[model samples]
Target: MSHTFDDQTHGADITRLFPEQATDTRSHPSRPKRGDLAASTADALAAAGAATLICTGHCKSEIQHVIDHISRKYKKVNMVFVTADTSSLASFHEAGRTIKKMGLQIDGFIGFPSVMAVPWEMTGDGHESHFQRNYLCYFLLVNILLDDMVHGSRVVLVTSCVRTEAPAPTWVDVRFSNGEDYHCLEGYSQSMLAMILFAKSLSKMCGDRSIAAFSANPGNTKTNVQTYISMDQMESWLERKRIEGEEIPVSLQQTPKSLAQGSATILRGLLDPDLQEESGAFLNHCQALKLPHLDFPAGEESAQALWRRSQEFLGAFL
Candidate 1:
């Protein structure tokens, strides 16, 4: 059966609400709503002669296309692309060194680099791929660059609605060993759930430094993140959810969002001044959601435990 997690309609049109906030709406007629928030903010940073850092994993060429377009259209904002293989912890350290070498103090950071529904595998660092890439890499990168981020800088972790569908994680067996019992969705969902918990913990950990962290669910938008999942796997997973009586929310299954629509919520979390005090909040549909019905241990203690466990996992770097 399907469930509605919030009163706000799922996949509601949010990109157009802040038309005035868009920076290049006239150029791209089909651009996602509020998609220009980043451009607008980048413009402001450019005006002040500040540098903004954007990181990508495998989609280098496509992002370069957008960067080139932005560079040509908006003379004020200068965008630079960095490549980091998140599957390896050393790559994150190297990324930190590279960014530090550039001498840029980050003003805004959006951590949306993730993998979804891939087969159960381990990174070179000996951790599950999803846990290492989706969650741990973000944790390490932010911590590595934490001191360089100016006060009041925002960090946004792009989570998903599937986080609500995660089974309560067995922290003792956090990696969900690559044995026969493993399902790809479990690791993906665990990483998603960990992102939220890490955001909450990060907010508290960085509260005194004036750094705010948030986890955002960018409704359902098809992106290259789904490239690895086969049709057969998805069908089997859905059927299993049915037979096992799992809570499949209609919002996640209902509408396929445009790129701009999918990014609207993450942009809100990044650029919305009103959410300054709402750090560690879970944002969906451009609104912060209170998911009291989540059947998992996503509380302060769990956040702390996850933090310590992550620190242990990456102890060599930290």
Candidate 2:
């Protein structure tokens, strides 16, 4: 664990780079009041309407870097970054509380807080397993703030195309803290499969609200998630890409994205007006792509199972 945290903020670390203004608190006439904004605000920006985009995750430097780049590029779009850890119930509650108190109209949300592993382990606070941090907490995040989002608000949950590449689970239980293993890649992939189920379920759940939920594959552009893989795996991937014309960022765990490039997929997820009709759709390379065959469950059956599973795990918060 090269980087981990309890509730404490780590300084000067790229992973802890959230803005000071995003601190979890209420009524700080100066603070929060809380939140994040997006790129779909041209009309909103012209009318001076504030569009909030809540981005929850730990990697501060990366988050800050993305926000700063977006701010500079879309000068008219008033983009605010509400950075918070979405790895646990407490942090989600703290973040949700502050954002609720602030009363900002959330137009979009991009959740990128996820992890992979060499083996099973507890997360930063030891409250949940790596699988929980990567997947379940995201479920909690949407349920926590779904009320704050108005009709037509968009949500893009960043996931890997690995969901399609790997096998689905034999079960749909949301808790991963039993301290178990079903093989590393399979376990990690199940959580991703859960992401697809959640999007499908939540979109159907909120059909009345008109809130759109989507899953996004950022096209293998890299960030810090690569470090979890051994160099052998990365190099093997690199070799495959070399034989073909394709070059991805997995060579010895090296990433191909610059700061601006890393932000592009998320920006597309949050800003693309064309995606409004693609609710419950999977966005591969930022376009509406067909979903892979879901082997476990299908239609409202899977969605209901997931909704029930989420309620069981996150019932306290909901």
Best candidate (score: lDDT): 1
| Candidate 2 Cα outliers beyond 4 Å, as residue runs | 1-83, 123-128, 163-177, 224-227, 231-262, 295-299
Candidate 2 structure quality by residue, lDDT tens digits, 114-230: 566446555664433545666677677667778877776667666666434233344544344354533354455566677766776767678788877877654434333453677
RMSD of each: 6.7, 11.2
Clashing pairs in 1: 15-33, 15-34, 32-260
In model 2, pairs of residues that clash are: 15-60, 17-60, 36-53, 37-53
What does candidate 1's lDDT look like per residue over 68-111, in tens digits? 65566656554665666778788778877777687776756766
Model 2 lDDT on a 0 to 1 scale: 0.51
Candidate 1, overall lDDT? 0.62
